[model samples]
Target: MFLGYHILTKFFKNGELSNDSPKESYLYYEKNAIDGDLQGIIQKLDYLKELGIDLIYLGPIFKSKTTHGYDITNYFSISENISSNSEEEAKAIFAKLIENAHKRGIKVIIDLVLNHASKEFDFDSVPKNLSVKTESPRSPQEERWQMSFLFWNLDDEDTREFLIRVGEYWLKNFELDGFRLDHALGLPLNFLEEFSIRMKKIKKDVTILGEVWEDEGDKLKNFNLLKKFKGNDAQRFTSMFDFATYDTIKEVLGKKNGSLLELYNQIVLSNQLNEKEFQLTYFIENHDLPRFIDICQDIETFYITLGLLMALTGNVMLEYGNEIALKGDQTIHNFHESGRVAMKFKEDWSEQEKKTFNYCKNLVDLRKVHSSLSSGSYELINSEENLLIFKKKTTYDEIKVLIYTGEQAYQLDKEYFDLISNNKVLKLKRGIYYLQ
Candidate 1:
């Protein structure tokens, strides 16, 4: 139910935006989309395929002069900077990519930023021209104390219409499999609710994923910058980035044996939501986080962390370049794009890096094999300062036990197979079993 991947290999950037080539800066690139340099990305498809990743989520690749394509000026076609806008050329490139991926049974999702258009967007009524006024007391935008919760004044009906039109245009023209909405918190809840409904009308199978950041609280409250009191219910987006989980993991990594109870509480909190809204995009470190290997300081912790993500029933995004141990101070715009460091694809990968890569690949494969891991029926088995354990049961009989921690290995109940190597049964309550 949860599809994964973040900031596409084609659209990643580091520091201030620049039109540099990926050669000059690994994450940087000129105006090139999937259609522009087909061979460039075509080569990397195998890596994702090998990882058993059937669903891919790409960041904005629309027409934009910036290295990152968040500032979208066009919606109906691929950015001219990246590819020819001719219908024939666009269709041909799309067909080839779709055919290739279908052969491998992979689905692609593109990021759609609906909250605000680029300053250069062709809209005549720009945010600057619009004036804020309380028209209707109960109007959704008016109900929120501010005329604009995001970039522009939502009070302007004209702006809302333009955004809605953009959504419809892309849905009809591109026939994309789904969308991973950017800044779902800034978007109006009513707008998204309607957009999701309209998308279904256009294509019954179209999926919608929202980039909803978790609010600062132990319990689920209003999403960050979302004002439910003012009728800005941002929770309309189908799924959100797992900021809550990421927050917990970040804390755990920085301090040894810290807040096991908090981690457990967060997981249980996520499980309580509706299944449709229950899924989270989980990751220890993403395009915005420092490298996972660097954060953990060792491969063993990374393996255990990887297991935790796969064992949970949610959509998990593995940053495109993270597999090769790409690292840098990626925070731009005050860490908005945390790990967008330059990449070195030409350099040979380390043996340890490849081993870590395969570990993730195997974990993903294992999740796909076990339905219980996908369909939630999970419970915390044991959680302590140094050891963590959980069980996922699909149909009462089909059960999976996931156990790992920073401490020496602990015992598990008999009948559990070593997920890494399916061999002898496991016994818990024993002495140290060093994780690293």
Candidate 2:
């Protein structure tokens, strides 16, 4: 049986993560960057629900020094910077947030940094032999410090047990759905397999999403490594964010001369390489890269890209504020911080922002209703220099998406229902057109 069977049955009808269901739609929120307390997050659950978000992936909430919270100091305590005045109060708020989310049928996944801890992590309690000595500075200007990898000494029983306990404590006590492991590529494969086994033992429905980014060549080579890590019982991870897709989308959409055929070919190649049993999460923007709006500038191009993302198969993840077209970059001193901005609620949004938000909301709703767009077989119907047309077909339905980036308008011969507007027949201009 699949490990997350309970979650699949409870939230999805297909018994798997598919684009047709709301369960696969993930919204990433940075606790520190967003303007809200733990209670504020709870209050916003209804807003997220309205956006068709079923899973909320929170950036590191553990005690940390940085605004992004990647440099975790304590795995057990909530960050004081983003939480209540007292640790006890913070725990209460965290518990309430999870409870409220579950009550609304939404799952919660928090970021976990297992590779390394903050400089202030209490390593005195850990054995010296378990830590790794490095000459490289911890930060840009900081002095070098000894860092302890959770399983640096693979045979160390103490470290293994400690990390396992940490994983279990959150699931058991907080009733959390799972974790989004940070820098998963740097961690040991053996440890990942073991950790998955232990976590499944606690809650079979728990989901584990890893962050792995690399070039196409390295990614293909690493697929073998991932398969081996899963071993006989594939329990390591439910899925990984599709960085390969992100790279392709970035290359084509970021530049003015990016080819539509080039983007189609890249998607076809990545889909061919994906493992049958595992799912790949797709996203246009995250905390790491520059915002999508900043890269694609034009509103028409932005809508086309968003439409393509919604049409693609697999779980779709949207960074907070992406719907509003928020712009920022890595050049703002702290690179990650530039991309991590406060959530822009609809109350204070401009006309353009409102239009973008509505467009995204419609796409999310469309994906939920159309199984072909989410879990169907894909085919490249037509590919040209400026226009690319693709079809997603399942047993029950079929969806054809036409993307036009050229300056001239294009007309369709047949009349088909427009998926985006839900009112008009198919007639293409210099933008994205979806027909069903």
Using lDDT as the measure, the top candidate is: 2
**lDDT (10s digit) by residue, model 1, range 1-436:** 7536554544432222222244433233432322223334445566567767777776675655455566666655565334344546755555555557667777777788766545555443324544322133333432442332225445467666556665666667654677888766666677777777777778776767766653334323532322231222223545566666667666675334366566767766665453554355666665445666666666566666666677667677777655555554533443435456544342466777677676667667767877766665767767777665566776633554544554454555555445555555555432212110
Residue 405 in candidate 2, Cα distance off native in Å: 0.8
lDDT of each: 0.56, 0.67
Error of 1 at 429 (Å): 13
TM-score for each candidate, following the candidate numbering? 0.77, 0.82
Model 1: colliding residue pairs: 330-338, 408-433, 408-434, 409-433, 409-434, 411-428, 412-427, 412-428
